[model samples]
Target: MTPTITDAPDRAEAAALLHAVADPARLAVIRRLADSPACVCDLQEQVPIALSLLSYHLKVLRAADLVTSRRRGRWLDYSLTPDALERLHAALPAPPPRHPGPTAGAGEAATPQPYTAACPPQCADQIQ
Candidate 1:
């Protein structure tokens, strides 16, 4: 969906947000977090990366505001931000709105002209 003007982030922040999920590991982390909150240990079980590496990915997710964390005793549990979907909605690089093609069978206007760039018939035979 095209975001409303108020829903869009400024350019630089948007770039950073897009970059956050650009990594495979981090994307996996976010995908899991989307379902529910998870601690680093919980994430490590699912992510193939080492603990240190997973932590690094989590840091990137946090920076993008794609995820949030809470400290419970020794564990840091990560969850998708309350507005994560909204930010995603805002961050989507909207496809340029398509112009309507001529309605199906609307008229001759819907037909494409034949290719005129082909070599002239005489030239075609010369190469043959």
Candidate 2:
């Protein structure tokens, strides 16, 4: 989806989200959630990080809305928020288009003769 400037979380909020995922360990946690939701114990198995560290990372993620947790018996299950992820992607500048220049060439037999069309009114080089 196109990302309007207002489409993202506020700058401060966005910064918070970026900071939450800044840690390498926490980033891995997000990646894991990308595949499937997991409880603390299940994440521990996948992350191989210390319990305290994992908890801290999860706290960061929760605060940023990147993840949501629910009580499941004694465990808290966490899942990714796809909208948050999309907002993150939208906030970042898009990569430039793959092909940027004129495609036609002199040696290309299928190339049409150069012809100028009426430029949009706002175009600086618009024909009179």
Candidate 3:
């Protein structure tokens, strides 16, 4: 089901979440975590960013509640929140439903030739 704005977080929270994932580095982290939980060391290897920068991105994800971390001995393993995907999906508007267009009958041109005159000057090359 398509999620309405009401189904997602408040405007500010939703914007924060969207902004958090908008970064390429953060997106890489999310994609890696989608496969399985991994330590910061592992993420560093995959994302290839400085540890401090990676941590900063992770912190942003945590603040958005899209990722969670668990401490194991001296290492912290990170994973996506259970509702992370749903929450992200809900933050955006759904595309309008598609409607069938009129079809041409046998031997009929799909586009009427007269309509070509309506094409803008920039589209002249494409009209024919």
Candidate 4:
């Protein structure tokens, strides 16, 4: 279904969230956090990006409310927000039904449906 006027804000928010994780480095950080909360140093080791670049990615995730950080002495630990999965799911448009409707007569070909955009395969599995 096409989005209505009221969906504009939702669509914008979803775009922001998706854009935040569009980067490979940010995705790596999210994947690592999904396993367990980790310090910035740990994320650096896992992602192999420069500390400044890592910080930039983390800042984007934090801005989108997908990630949270807690200070432990001089280091900071990052983790996914409690509602991260739910928020991601809500942001995505619901997929169209897999099968054609009963309107198709026996032995008749079903009408072709329009293509619908969805999360990329790499991101889809992680979110679900």
Can you write out model 4's per-residue Cα lDDT over 1-128, one digit (the tens) per residue?
Answer: 34322377888988888788889999888889989999999999999988999999999999999999999999999999987766776777777655645798766657775443586777766664
Worst 10-residue lDDT window for candidate 4 reads: 1-10
Give the C-alpha miss distance for residue 93 in model 3, angstroms: 1.5
| Model 4, backbone clash pairs (residues 3+ apart or across chains), number | 0
Q: Per-prediction TM-score, please?
A: 0.67, 0.70, 0.73, 0.71
lDDT for 76 in candidate 1 is: 93
lDDT for 50 (candidate 4): 88
Model 2 TM-score on a 0 to 1 scale: 0.70
Candidate 3 lDDT over residue span 1-128, tens digit each: 64557533466667888999999999999999999999999999999989999999999999989999999999999999998988888787776554443686665545534345778877877765
Global CA lDDT of candidate 3, please? 0.86
- Residue 60, model 1: lDDT of 82
* Preferred candidate (lDDT higher): 2 or 4: 4
Ranking by TM-score: 3, 4, 2, 1
lDDT of 2 by residue, 3-114 (tens): 6445444665656767878898888899899999999999999899899989988988888888999999988999998786776775556775443237745554443433
Spell out the clash pairs found in candidate 1: none
Estimate the overall C-alpha local distance difference test score of candidate 2: 0.77
- Specify the highest-lDDT model's number: 3
Worst 10 residues of 3 by lDDT: 107-116
Clash list (residue pairs), candidate 2: none
